[model samples]
Target: MMKARIHQRPKSSMQSGKAKVGQWLLDYEPAEAKRLDPLTGWAGSGDTSAQVRLAFDDLDSAVAYATAKGIDYDVVRLGANPLKLQAYADNFK
Candidate 1:
């Protein structure tokens, strides 16, 4: 059985504005353990599902897709994004 994870995307560190923070993402768990490649010594596996990332507008849509696809999934809910507002003069304190 395929397993997946659903979670909200957090604000990126590079941007001051929140973008796509409301989007939910579905990531498939790796079905097999990664093994070291003999030639390059890089970890890789035959399971391609781990590379797939599905985005949804909300949690319900993501969950619904998983349910309809018969994929067992776990949802990870995070607390609200913390935003601290302060005046420029506050930096002097």
Candidate 2:
């Protein structure tokens, strides 16, 4: 079984922006099924969307398959590409 996790946070310290981003993530469902985290306010209701996705596989073959399809790395090492979030969602299916 494979799993993908997506997280979204406000882009700034504005209630409106946080609400907007939260609503967007809540309503937007990518190709892969995802679980949304509870709405959390930081810096006193900020306006920013800090999102992330984690994809897991039990076997190397599965990881290879995901990578071949352009899936991003799960580990957050140096020089990690944020664009890989979509790739993870793409493989969620």
Candidate 3:
């Protein structure tokens, strides 16, 4: 059976803006461990499904799609969203 993971897009560590933070993502799990090519010395795998990523607007849709396709998936839910309000002047204090 195909295995997949469904989770929300994480907040960017480089920027503060929360744009597209909640978008759900479906990613296939790697079926086999990557092996190093003896000739080129490059790490690669034959499982191309691991490269596919499907975006969903919400968790429900992502779950539905996985169920319809008979894919075994695990949903990773994030903790409660916490917004900390602060002022620029507070940075100096």
Candidate 4:
């Protein structure tokens, strides 16, 4: 008999700067580019959040896609959009 190895999925952390950017895009950006939130469940009350990254191949493509999806601001707070968050990140870079 051959032994099988079990692989585990990595835990998602919002503490990482990369993750923070992804979260901002998912939450505030339009919608299309937002990836399904990795942390959602049937009994969880709502759909999982989504995420996006600045390092994506095409910024314009991502923005266009997101815009077509009809942005949702349910989880986003006032004065906290992707544009502003991105600006903040640039400062650190």
Candidate 5:
């Protein structure tokens, strides 16, 4: 069975306007083992699911997609949105 995670995107550390903060993301955990390349010694997995990231406007849509695909997912809820408004001019103060 494939394991997935559903969560909201974390706020940017830059304290910019919350333009894309409301989006939710669905990510899959890798079910494959990483193999080291003998030539370059680079480690990587062949699992394409690990590379897929589906974004949704709402939490329900993210969960619904996971259910339709038979994927077992864990929803991680983020803390309340940050309310500390900042301004570029404040940096100079």
Candidate 6:
């Protein structure tokens, strides 16, 4: 059976924008074995599903996609981080 992961995108610590925080991402777990090419000594897989990343505006939509595709998924929920409201003058202090 194919497994997928559903999780809300975490806010970037480097910036204070909410561009991708509200989005949920669905990622497929790799179910295929990676084989090394003897000529190049490189590992790769032919499974294209592992490379797919589906983004949804809501968690329900992401879950629905996995259910419709019959993929077993594990939802990872994260609690909201507490924010310390600071002003520009606070930086000087």
Specify the highest-TM-score model's number. 1
Best by lDDT: 3
Q: Which segments of candidate 6 are over 4 A away from where they belong?
A: 80-92
Error in Å for residue 11 of model 1: 0.7
Model 1 lDDT-worst window of ten:
78-87
lDDT of 1 by residue, 1-93 (tens): 999999999878998798898999999999999999999999999999999999999999999999999999999999855878789999999
Clashes within 3 Å, all models in order: 0, 12, 0, 2, 0, 0
Candidate 4's C-alpha runs over 4 A off are 1-47, 50-55, 72-93
lDDT of 4 by residue, 1-93 (tens): 111111122225545344323322323332233345456732222322323222223334444545566542222233433433355567887
What lDDT score goes with residue 74 in model 4?
A: 28
Candidate 1 clash figure, as a count = 0
| Model 6: per-residue Cα lDDT over 1-93, one tens digit each | 899999998989899788889899999999899999999999998998899899999999998889998999999999866877789999999
TM-score per model over all chains: 0.90, 0.20, 0.85, 0.24, 0.79, 0.75
- Candidate 6 overall lDDT versus native: 0.92
- List pairs with backbone clashes in candidate 6: none
Candidate 3, pairs of clashing residues: none
User: What lDDT is reached at residue 10 by model 3?
Assistant: 94
lDDT of 2 by residue, 35-58 (tens): 454675323222122233323323
Candidate 5 C-alpha lDDT tens digits along 1-93? 999999998878898578778899999999999999999999998899999999999999999999999999999997765687689899999
lDDT of each candidate versus the true structure: 0.94, 0.35, 0.95, 0.34, 0.91, 0.92
Off by over 4 Å in 2: 1-58, 75-93
From the highest lDDT down, the ranking of the candidates is 3, 1, 6, 5, 2, 4
Better of 1 and 4 by TM-score: 1
Please write out the lDDT profile of model 3 over residues 31-67, one tens digit for every residue. Answer: 9999999999999999999899999999999999999
RMSD of each: 1.6, 18.5, 2.1, 16.3, 2.9, 2.6
Model 6: weakest 10-residue lDDT segment is 77-86
